[model samples]
Target: MRYLAGNPFSAVTLPATLAPEWSLQIERALAPELLRALRESLDAHCARPGDEAAQCRIARAAIGLMVDSGLRRAEAAGARRSGVKRVDGIRGQSMWTLTLVGKRSKVRTVPASPATLDALRAH
Candidate 1:
């Protein structure tokens, strides 16, 4: 059984009835190596010289955040659809960040990695 609270963002409590094998399958599917390989292949495909190089750079960064950071599909979509923002930190340091309305309409922040920052700069 699963029980939900009045607040959507509140966690749902569910009986621990999932089969161990099924959980293992999910773990394998989300393995870091597989995600890393996917990110590298997409980056390579986008890095090839082309008229769409500019667009490719942005796509590559998004893919990195999605695969490396484990962003939810909705979070990724919202970031691209609504756009990201740059903020200046202490002493004029700048960083790229995106606020995404994720599960249950909860707002969360995802930081850009150095590689992602470089890709954003290139684009």
Candidate 2:
């Protein structure tokens, strides 16, 4: 049953075809909890007053953008280089967006959060 279920090309219906559910359960069970704590620590570091604080602020903002938008590493790097630009949104109100070239030379625009915009401005 497991073999047949794993094989997408199999024509037979298996009595036990729980691969998708099992995969999701396994992923949830193995997921890390420390990442959240680490993110909190980074945010705190960015708030501190010191010479490195400026760098920390940028790091926090970049990481926040990545997490919020699910941006690829290359996309994030390109965003940093090109920076965020303000443009007219759907209703003509100004909004922040990041424009960069992704894989295959595709031009992609990523919406920027207020924090990201402030961080880019700081940089």
Candidate 3:
């Protein structure tokens, strides 16, 4: 009898469609690690004495927000004050949540760590 099984070399049974074009879409974008480290360092620069008040606050706020949200740089820029909120969830844990528009017009909810709240308060 003829072989009943499919191609032995193939791992899947797909109909042979074109591979996904992630570059042309906003679904698969990611930030480079080196740039992220640089930005974090720059944000922390404000901790130095004699730093400009406004610039430092901006940096701190930016950095802390990113760290808290675990989002890319672009997402941080789209953050809005109106979307920030403090809520007490289970176990009486209170935290700040940020709602913002992400890539591909997706809306996401991001949490702010204590550090981020402090920075926002400072400004």
- On TM-score, the candidate that comes out on top is 3
List, residue by residue over 5-87, the lDDT tens digit for candidate 3.
67775776656333321222334434569547755675666666665756878877887777656667898988889989998
Residue pairs whose backbone atoms clash in candidate 1: none
Which residue segments of model 3 deviate by more than 4 Å? 1-51
lDDT of 3: 0.72
Every candidate's lDDT: 0.63, 0.64, 0.72
After superposing candidate 1 on the true structure, give the runs of residues whose Cα lies further than 4 Å from its correct spot: 1-29, 51-55, 80-97
Candidate 2 residue lDDT tens string, 48-91: 88978888877877776675555667767766555567888777
lDDT of 1 by residue, 1-123 (tens): 345535765587865442211111133246678767866776776778886766777777667666544566677766663446777888999887666666655566666667776665676
TM-score of 1: 0.51
lDDT of 3 at 44: 69
Write down the TM-score for model 3: 0.59
- For candidate 2, what is the TM-score? 0.57
Full ranking by lDDT: 3, 2, 1
What TM-score goes with each of the models? 0.51, 0.57, 0.59
Point out the higher-scoring one by lDDT: 1 or 2: 2
